[model samples]
Target: MLETVTSPTLLVSERRVRANLERMAARANRHGLALCPHFKTHQSLEVGAWCREYGIEEITVTSLRMARFFAAGGWQKIAIAMPFNPREIGELQVLSQRVELSLFLVDSKGAAKLAAELSAPLGYFIEVDAGYGRSGVSWRDHASVRSIIRAAGHHRFRGFYVHSGHTYDAKTIPEIAAVHQELLDRLGELQSAFSDLHPIMAIGDTPACSTQEEFRGIDRIGPGNFIYYDLTQVQLGSCGLGDIAACAAVPVVQHKGEEIIVHGGWVQLGKDSLHLPSGPTIYGRMVLLNQDGQWDTSRPMGTVTKLSQEHGTIHLPESLRAEVRVGDLVGVLPVHSCATVHGLRATGDTRFLA
Candidate 1:
């Protein structure tokens, strides 16, 4: 569909996205849970529309701007999936007016104070630090949790939310399932406490949602990475290479010595590092392209060997370099889908389906 697709062009596959979405959605449905997929990973209006096509009415986002984007795209229910930032209060208020905005409140007192000042009725979910130490109220800190909840003081409490980001490091499926259950059990206890006030429990991260089997008390599941199953997702056992929904379409600009250079540099794909056992300098992986626009496995090529601000160097066998020439388009797999998104511009920020 992308006729002019060339170097550094990021493309998402419709079939793979639909399949991954259906698989995850079915898993949640079987357990009677709602899938409120996170929108920050893809950040595409078209991908947002695909989420809706799969019956995802409620969604989660990492920023106020993202929430605004999806709301403008016609999604009426959205949750801002990060700690409250006072500076975005005006944008949040504007989004709240158009759609129901569910804000994350790690500090109950701070959220209550902010909520009181808002001009409209707002809902909130207390962010609990299940295992990830990023930003959340400690799961075991009951007194702090109670104090924070009390701080709400009649302000609407939506429910409890937790994102088990630590699951990304799991080397095995069993390990990932273990972390999923652990998160659910911790959130379940808090859910029992405020049984009548709020009724939804939101947990995200593709690794947990796509692999784990037991999702009993989770009222809603939010997974964004499934849209474009990246190399990270594949390494995490989330999906296979064919399941990758998004990829970078780049051109081979040169074939020097035993290295191949592509127009796609860190500026287009990002310098997301993956720490391998031997070392820690892999920027990304390359997908060999055939004449018919398919991946050629015979020529594995090389990894994204090095990256400067504007150049991407690939180290491979000298034989492969001779075959690839300038003006040839190649596909580079992303280590992290979110980091790849940072390379895109304003139009790249949101790609919609016609």
Candidate 2:
């Protein structure tokens, strides 16, 4: 049933993509919040256009290059969620003139320096750590945050923004809600502390955004990975397999015992792994596809147990070995959608995205 496909390919279901976008947009609108989805997920101009169909004019991207790409693609407002890049000062200055550009600031001194360097007006947000253990001002670093907020005097201060990454560690919905409540409480305190400034809340990260039903005081939510929910999101209970919009199609090349080797590997999908319900840690789950190459949600065949640079070996049960064979095309759902697409864009063939 899969003889024509000659190489590894990432297949996206337009139906699921649109449905995900609309679902998030509606949810944000219901909560009276802005859904500026991160464009770093798909990075395709075509995908950007799909977002526009839902009346999403404001968007988020990781780098200045992506900001410019989407800006030229007709996105009216863009927030570069990453830290302000000194190397792209010139490009940042240019992008600000063309669109409403925003960046993340962690240091007061750095904020002042950027305000002085940027020729055009720009918006800025103080990066709040929110227990992510990554970049951002720690919730307890009130003194430093105050200094940065003051230093961002001339520049447009957007407010306190955070990537609710701690929710990623949560394995259940209750755990996700607990982390969300703590962040919300901290955000509330920030709002009151800076009452004179009246900053808006910008909370992001897909785990909390998708699982939690409430948004107490959030002004905007940017859940990037929800566009293509992956194995990790499923394990975290953010979404189901039916909600996963993308799949990788690889040509099966060998069968050693019960394992089926495919042409796709780490370069095709990222090295992210997840422990499945069946109690096996695998890079990606072997998914089934309909005749149209769309995802078949009925069942997953197995898991990609081992991966080399150009080969992935999936462990299938004896009952399903005959159902799949060498020279056939198999479907895989990556563990992390973000890393997978980035890998494809970074090292795959030029025609990979198409």
Candidate 3:
């Protein structure tokens, strides 16, 4: 299988991926929380099937297109984690009839509009901005939150969906725990305030989901990146480097002294970088591929220091640089596996290892 790689290919390890899924499922079960894992990471039906093996029937996707893809693939319960877009109402209506579709609502206006236009029966969750200012209604704004819930007139108000994405910026496990605690505190207050509605409390984010053990108020978790731990996860103390299940297999194109250029670039690996403490940024970690087509993480070969449109430069030491040649298949453990997979899949260059 290692010999067959001619271009930048996204390689997935079934063993590692299953282990990751099983671990997350166990975590959710231990806390008595429903695991509606976000499938926006791998976006592979093959990977989604693996989630079923662990008793995951509910899933969360980033878009309606992804929801349709998984719905056609037999996922009966799906949640579009992104904010509701009225422009996709036509497709949303079709999808709602096919599956138990749920959507995220951040504003009362959007909810009111949806209530008026939507004829199909579906559930909607209020996306709370729990310190992650990227989107969602501010957790501090109870008036806005209540307005959205009331505006969700006919649609079943599911629960609050909080993505404490800021946890990713934390440097330590304790920092991640602090973010989780704040989220729990906010959700607890929301649940208490809206006790009459009986809303389910839900939260999703790889950092908080992976590190925190006590999900005091969370009813459902939809972590996606945990399915394939990446360098970013490792840096955030969510997972170790050995737990990363995805790698970009690119052919060695040239050896320029200590730098080995590979066919993989931003087009294949994306531009997500990991800033090292040594004052340099790296796109990925290099590893040697064994004959069985698996990456060997035992030996740290080098780091992908630079990436252009069609090439990546791996800064290797003298001893390791001598071991590779042009046309040899080398592996790069991605900094952000989700973005990396998305990039490779866009070019139709990805393979799953059985």
Which candidate number has the best lDDT?
A: 3
lDDT order of candidates, top first: 3, 2, 1
lDDT of 1 at 37: 85
lDDT tens per residue, model 3, 1-354? 777768888899999999898899999999999999999999999999999999999999999989999999999999999999989987899888889999999888888889899877679998989898998988888999888878878899888998888998899999999988988998888889888888889999999899889999778999999999899999888998888999998899898988999998999899999999888899999998887668878786689999998789999967787799998988999999988999888874677875
Whole-model lDDT, candidate 3?
A: 0.90
lDDT of each: 0.77, 0.82, 0.90
Clashing pairs in 2: none
- Candidate 2 weakest lDDT stretch, 10 residues: 345-354
Preferred candidate (TM-score higher): 1 or 2:
2
Tens-digit lDDT track of model 1 for 1-354? 333555466666677778888898889888888889888888777778778887889889998888878888898998899888877777777778889988888886586677577857788888889998889888787777677668766556777788889998797788898888888888888778767766588888899888878877788888888877787877778888778766666777887867788877778787787766677577777776654345543456577888886678877655566666677777677888777766854223222222
Q: What is the lDDT of residue 237 in candidate 1?
A: 85
Per-candidate TM-score against the hidden true structure: 0.91, 0.94, 0.98
lDDT of 3 at 67: 94
Query: Model 2's lDDT to the true fold?
Result: 0.82
Candidate 2 Cα errors over 4 Å, as ranges? 1-4, 347-354
Highest-scoring model, TM-score: 3
**Residue pairs with clashing backbones, model 3:** none
| Model 1 alpha-carbon miss at residue 179, Å | 1.8
Order the numbered candidates by TM-score, best leading: 3, 2, 1
